[model samples]
Target: MSTARQNPLSYDEAVTWIQQFSKSSIPRDQVTASFSRSSGPGGQNVNKVNSKVSLRLQLDRATWIPPHALQKLKTSPLVNKAGELQTTSDRTRSQGKNLQDCYDKLIQAIKQAVTVNRPADLEALAKIEKR
Candidate 1:
């Protein structure tokens, strides 16, 4: 398990956290991948190659994600009732490429979930109150 970032982070801190977290890799033990034959216009290649990759990240096992992000992620469509973040890729005929695509999707989803809107400034609030 990895240390998680705290909630209510400043805008700069959240940006920095996103950058650092994006570069870091998810633990392999927390992710599982399964491959199946792709269903698309590849003719025999699609029929023969099990290139479609289905990646599942067990969110409960990933203690690295911040609590705020995890809470948001739970509402995302990528997560099912099983509390797992599921992604799939059939963009390529190679299993490796498809698997990488799934990883990319997962990473993007997590980053999106972690992003928070900047808080309104106290001065701005005060000015609005004067109206």
Candidate 2:
């Protein structure tokens, strides 16, 4: 189900929803969030403050997602060799926004991973191919 999420969705729970097909809460302690100075423009602002947020979820330690969901997510591009879900954002100058962007991106990726096309969708696509 697609919900209009308000700003600052719970980062860890977002990950859970992606793979688990549920919006259960993940423990905050399992997430590792670090901020570093963002690259690119913004002149002095870029050089002065750490605006980029690197949010990492330790997959090995994650217990919130169902077993099947974990297996599916592990196969997605978001998971690295270290079994960590890593994402970073500097889309906005504000660290908070960047953090949210990264989290949103992670959720988006999870949604994509779990998506399945139905027979009706395939038939519609095939009809287009016949054109």
Candidate 3:
């Protein structure tokens, strides 16, 4: 059981924890990121600077995540028509931050789908043991 905690875990921290538990490694090459100009205001200036970040990942190419987690990811809402997982971030003006935000979103989604409820999981396993 987790001990006392004060602050909530950040997305990157959660991803790290999940990675440790799953013994998985996320490959950077598998992630493709694109930057486009942020919309609204600044007309030509907006078109010139690419502040929005878009990220794409292929589920078929994912290998490090646990099988159960992969299965969950396949059915997740993050999957697109092309069977690719996609995410974006444009709220921030900084291109770098936007890119990181996109990555964080992807990680958080995968973590949520993969992470099981410990109490419920233990209960289910206990029932199996009785049989």
The lDDT-based order of candidates, best leading, equals: 1, 3, 2
Model 3: weakest 10-residue lDDT segment is 1-10
lDDT of 1 by residue, 1-131 (tens): 23444464567766877898752568988898999999955779997889999999999877787777887888889997899999999987789988888989999998887787898999999999999
Residues 8-57 of candidate 3: C-alpha lDDT, one tens digit per residue: 34455545668675213568778788888888445566667898888988
lDDT of 2 by residue, 64-94 (tens): 5544455677887878788988888988789
Question: How much lDDT does each candidate structure score?
Answer: 0.84, 0.70, 0.72
* Candidate closer to the true structure by lDDT (higher is better), 1 or 3: 1
Best by TM-score: 1
Model 3 off-target regions past 4 Å? 1-24, 40-45, 120-131
Q: In candidate 1, which residue pairs get closer than 3 Å at backbone N, Cα or C atoms, i.e. clash? A: none
Each candidate structure's count of clashing pairs: 0, 0, 0
TM-score against native, each model: 0.83, 0.65, 0.68
Q: Roughly what TM-score does model 2 have, to 2 decimal places?
A: 0.65
Candidate 1: 10-residue stretch with minimal lDDT: 1-10
Q: Which is the better candidate, 1 or 3, if ranked by TM-score?
A: 1
What are the runs in model 1 whose C-alpha is more than 4 Å off? 1-6, 121-131
